[model samples]
Structure formats: C-alpha cells, structure tokens
Target: MIGIENIIFLIVAALGIGLFVWQIRKIRKNVLLGRDVELADNPSERINKTLLVAFGQQKMFKRMLPAVLHLFVYVGFIVINIEVLEILIDGIFGTHRVLGFVGPLYSGLMALNEILAALVIIACVMFLWRRNVTKVPRLATGVEMRAWPKVDANIILVVEIVLMLALFVFNIADMKRVLLAGEEVVGLYPVSQFFVDIFGEDPEQLYIIAKVGWWFHILGILAFMNYLPSSKHFHIIMAFPNVYYSKLLPKGKFTTNPAITHEIKAMLDPSYQPPAPEVDAEGNPVMQRFGAKDVEDLTWKQLMDSYTCTECGRCTSVCPANLTGKLLSPRKIIMDTRDRMEEKGEHPAIFAPNHYKELGVERVETTDEKTLLRGYITPEELWACTTCNACVESCPVNIDQVSTIMDLRRYLVLEESAAPASLNAMFTNIENNGAPWAFPASDRFNWADELYVPSKN
Candidate 1:
C-alpha cells in the first residue's frame, strides 16, 4: 500500500537517524576515554537539581531579557515537535492530516502550534540582533567566539527562523487547498490564516506550495538533529545528565589525592602499609600519575562537562581572573578540553588499536605530540585562578570549571614541582614550621601576647 513518495521518505528518515546514532556513539566513546569516578550518591537530590537547572531554567533567570526570550524559543521548540509526530505518521502511510481525526482536540493543538511558531520566529530574530547588532559582551567576546563559534550561533538562529516560516507557509497553503476542495478546514490556523490569500485559489499551485513547505520543515528538523553533535547546541541533549552528575560538595572543598594521603598516613604511622598498585591484564603494574596531564587523566564526568558546555560565557563573564586582565577564561578552559578530546578522537589508532586494525590501516605514530596541558592550556592560566567558584556558580548547566583548574594545578605542583616561587616558600614553611609563616609554632601566639589575660581560678 506504500506509494513511491512514502518509500523515499522511509529511506531518507533511516539515513538521517542512522547517521545521528553513529555520531552519538562516537561521542560516547570519546567521553568514556577519561578515568572513572563515582558520582552515584544522593539520587533524589540529583534528580531535583536536574529538574530545576535543566528543565526549569532556574539559573538562566539571572539575566531577565535573554531568559524570557530563550524561554519562548525553548518552550516553542519542544512543544512544536509534537506536531512532527503527526507529520511522520502521515509521511509513512501517505495519508493527509491523519491526526485531524481527533476533531476539536486537533484544532486546539494546531492553534497552539501556530502561535508558538510565531513566537519562536520573533525570539530567534531578537537573538540574532543581539549577537550581530548589539554584540552582547558575554556572547560576542572571547577568542573562542571569533571564528566558527560565531558563525555557528548565527547559522542556528537563521535556520530556526526559516523553519518557523516554512511551518506557517505550509499551514496557510494547506488551508487554501482545503477551502478550494469545498471541505471544512481540519485544524485552526490563527497565525497562518492571515497569509492564506497569498497563494491564489488555484488548486495545483496551493498543493505544490504546501508540499514544498512540509518537506522543508521536516527535512530541516532531521538536519538539525544531525548538526547538534558538532554544534554547541548539543547542550540541549547533554545538559540534563551533566546537571544530574554535578558536584554536590561545598565549592571551597578540594579533592585530595589518595596517593598523597596514603604517604602522609605512612609517615605518621610506621605500621601502616599502602595498597598495592593496580595491574594491567598482562600482570604489568600500571604507573599512576598524580594529577591530570591530559584528557585521559580526567574523570568521565569532567569530560562530559566539556561536551555539555553551552558556550554561553556566563562562567567567563563572572571569572575574577579574566576580569582582572589575567590570561584565564573558564570558558576557554572547557573549550580547550573539548578540542583536545576531538583531536584525540580523530586518531583511532591512538585510542583503539583493535578498531584501527579492523580497518586495515597501517599503525603509524601521530606527528602531533601536543598535550592538553602545555599545548591547549597554559601554566599561567591555571595558576591565575583564585579558586573563587564564581565560574561554577554562574554556569547555567552546573559545569565545574574550577575543579578542572585545581586538577591541572595539582599536576604542576605534585608531578612537575612547578609551583610558583612564592607558593614554594609557603610549602617549605608549612613542612618545617607547621604553618605558612617562617616562624616556629611556639611563637604563633606572640601577636596576642600584649592583650593576653590568663584565666585565674
């Protein structure tokens, strides 16, 4: 019972969905390349946080105007997708307005969709103006925003505008077609009704226009789905899980290295013995590094944070180090992490030998020997952080930018002994004098000696 058009639709849909799945799998593999860390505690709290931050857009309200506009676009994008389901059903079976059978309910849904589509168009236009004309500092500034990132934002906004317009054109033309046939229009077209007369009463012309608009809208959705992985808009899918797995501890609390803790314990108690080093599958002991020198050294959640970044620049805008004319930008740090991951991901032989062998390609050493530490992020940037957690608090998606900064600092201090000269002096004082001061512990109370009054019983 399938027509040629229905068969072609099936083929195109399969190709589009299959390509998206493949890219998603590749991204999943890249994220899992990092070391594992347990984040399975406090399930109920995690869910509530996810709902508030991701679904409720709680953090986005800090800026009122953009938040309101974003809400229109966000809600409209999601709610309008319900109509896509009906489109899919019609496309597969070669039926016309199949959901129109729902009678009054269908009319109500169509009316709502029309209004939302109009709102989305307006919101997207305003967003485009902000980016191009007004040049919002957070959205426009940043070395990362200069080239492709800038173009990508504009492209998405323009695409959204075109898609909404296509929806209106499709509705208006279809209404005209129904009227020409002397049949009652199935769905209400509040927004589209004004444009219904644009396409003359010619039956053939209305049918062609309607078909073009419908095809353009649906095809645009599929293309947009595939584009998400490569675009910053991937946050739409990654934000929920990223927020759920966010760090729950106090911002000032830093995670200490277990290897260092074990060493300290051994120094205090001679009877204490540290655990044995982990071995590989071949029984060779794995050499563990102290801190993250590369993406593989970071936790899986940290890598996920990289991909989940919305590039909204909220973190960078609030970064004290950046505001004070320092080389550090928290947004740049996260973007660098993602860039490194993508660089490594491109070379399958570097990560997966088995897969590379299956492809019948010769295993060759990569010419680029750059690492995430020196190549992507500089030492100056890592040391500039005040550890204020301003970036973490400002992030709409709960990305822990400070944690990554701390981990990089740990690598420099513990592994390379590369802490700045001032910090080295403090470390020596703490080791020898039990404090950050050069004086002995016995003289610590000397400052209060003048005002001291011993308790007399």
Candidate 2:
C-alpha cells in the first residue's frame, strides 16, 4: 500500500542518509591517517567531564550573555528536532499529524516546539548582531576568522533563522487550513497562533503554503547535517567525544615519548639495554618517528582534536606568544593541522595501491613538497611557545596545541639538528656541565653559601 509520494519521500531520505554516511567515512579515514595513541584510561572521569563541558556547556558560561543566547539556540535546536521524528513518520506514511491522536500530549508538545522555534529565531538574530555589529574581538580578530570562517558563522545563523521561521509559518498555515475547513484545533501553536491572522482563510492557498513550509524545514535540516562535516559547526557533533577523550594529565605535565626516552637513556648509559620496540595488536613494530614532520606523525587523538576544534580562538587569544606579537597562534596551529589532513584526504596518493609504481619509486612516498613543519607551520611559530599551558587551559574542547608544537620542536631538534642557536648553546651546557648553566655542577651550590639562611625552630 505504498503510494508514489511515499516512495519519493523514502528515496530522498535514503539519499540524504547515504551522502552523510559517505562524508563520515571520509572523515574517519582522514583521522586514521594519524599515528596510534593510547587514551583509554579513566573512563568514569572522562564521562563526567563530557557531561559537564559538552552537555552542560560549562565552559561557554564563562562569558554569560553569549552563553545564554547560544544555550537558547542549542537547546531549541535539539528539542525542536524531536518533532522531526514525527515529520519523518508522517512523510513515509503520507499521513497528516499522525501524532495528533495522542490527545493533550500532542498539543503540549506542539506548544513547546513553537516556543522553542521562536526562541531559536531570536537567538540567531542576536548572535548575528554580536558577530557583525558588536564584532566580538575574540571571534573577529584572528586571521583564521577572516574570509570563509566569518561568512560561515553568519551563514549558519541565517539558515537557522530561516528554518525556525519556516516552522512557524508552516504551523500558522496549518492552523489557517484547519480553521477554513471548520475543523476544531486539536494542537496548540502558541507562537504561531499570532500568525494565524496573517495567513488568511483560503483553504487551497493555505494548503500550498503549509506544504512548501514543511518541505523547506525538513530539507533544511538534512542540508544542515551534511554541512556540519565541512563547517566549524562540526564541533556540535564532535564536542561530546572530544571532551570525553581529553587529556587527563595535569596541565603543565609534559608527556615524553617513550621511544625517544629509551634512545636517550641508551646514549647516556652504554651498559643499558633499551627496551624492545612496542608492537601493535597486529604484532608489527610501532614505528616511532622522533617528532611530527607531517600529519601522519601526530597521534590519532591529536587529529581528532583538530576536527573537534570550534575555532573559537580562545586559545590564541590567551596565548602569551600571540599576545606578545610572536607569530604563534594556537588556533592557527590546529587549523593548519586540519587543513593538511583534509588535503591529504582529498589527494590520497599515499594510500593508492600502485602509489610506488605511479611515482616511479622503490617505496611509496607519502610526503610531497608540502609538510606540516615548514610548509604549513613554521619553525619560528613552534619556538615561540613559552610552555605556559595557557592555550590548553583556555581551550573549551581541550585541544592540546602545545603538545603538537612540542612534537614538531622535537623533530627539529632530534632528527634535523635544527635547534636555534640559543637552545643549542643551552643543550651543550647541559651535556658538558650537567646543568643549563655554563659552570660545572660542583659550583651549583656555591651561590647558596654566600646567602644567609634562617634556622629551623
């Protein structure tokens, strides 16, 4: 008992779903290009963190007004989407208001939806005003926020406004149609009830308007879903898991790569037997590149952090290096990582079966002229970090921009022997004198002898 209209609805839904799945697969493949990392510890704590930050929007509340406005849009969007389920069911069955049989419950739900839709529209307008008129410095100042990013933010707000309006108009038209046919109002449309007078009492016209509004609202939702993967708004979906998998260590504690540590120890003690190279689940030795020369050298969690980044620029805004006029912007570091990853995803020459053959080489060459180190991010930017952890502390999603910077720095120092002159001098002092000072370790306590000390009571 499937009609042509029902078949068309099914086809459209299938296509939307298929496209979203394809995009998701592409993103997963891109994220998997990163090196393996273990962040499986502390499940209970991670869940709690996710609930507090992502679900509760705890970090966003630090700035009160914007957070409230965002909460409106966020809560509204989520609550309003509940009605989309009913829309889908009705579309497939070619039935009108199928959930209306729920008596008073349906009316309550309808009232709630209308109120939320109105709130969403108002919030979107306020957000647009804040971005365009007020020009919040944190949002507007960064180089990354230029061009497409600025437009993208505005575009999402406008689209949300349009969608909310469509929902309101659809309800108004539906009520008008019901009134024209002398039918009783079964559902409440609190906000849209005011619009009933605006939409006059022509049954045929109201029906057409209602149909158009219904189609636009659903179609807009589908388009928004697909748009997320390519937009900074991908944070909406990524924020939860990103917060859950966040680095649980103390902010200032640096994680030294074990492979590098073993090598250093072997160099220091000739009799020391370095531990065997760690093997993966597949029994293959996990290749340890001293530092990140490209995206693949970074850990998978780091790659995930790039996608999860909201590009809110809080990290960069608080970054001492950036604030002090150094070239390092923490936000730019994350954006570059994401950009390089996306570039690799698009080209995919590295993963091709006949990649070596195509390149006319013995082994497959993954890297080309471009690299994460010198190509996207410069050594100057890497060296500017004060290791203050301010960037990590400021990040809403807990993206570890500092770790990525340090990894690249490790590559420059260990593999390329490209440390800056001042650091090289310090390194030489450490190696020969057993400390950062040029003087021997025996003289380290010499200054203390000249100073007066208080006696313990």
Q: Using Cα atoms with residue i matched to residue i, what is each candidate's TM-score against the true structure?
A: 0.92, 0.90
- Provide the clashing-pair count of each candidate structure: 0, 0
* Candidate 2 wrongly placed segments (more than 4 Å): 268-271, 278-286, 347-368, 450-457
TM-score of 1: 0.92
Tens digit per residue, CA lDDT, model 2, 1-457: 4689778888888888788888888888989998877888999999999988889888888778878888888888788877898888888988888889998999999998898888888898988888899987878875555566777788899999999988887889988898888899878999887779786777888999998898889888888888888777889888888898888889778777777678788999988899878898999997777888989999888888988987788898889999988878898788878878887764221211112223353222223447777766778888989989888887877788999999899999989999999999999999899998799888888887868779999
Query: Which residue segments of model 1 deviate by more than 4 Å?
Result: 346-369, 452-457
Give the Cα-based TM-score of candidate 2 against the true structure: 0.90
The true-versus-predicted C-alpha distance at residue 75 of model 2, in Å, is 0.6
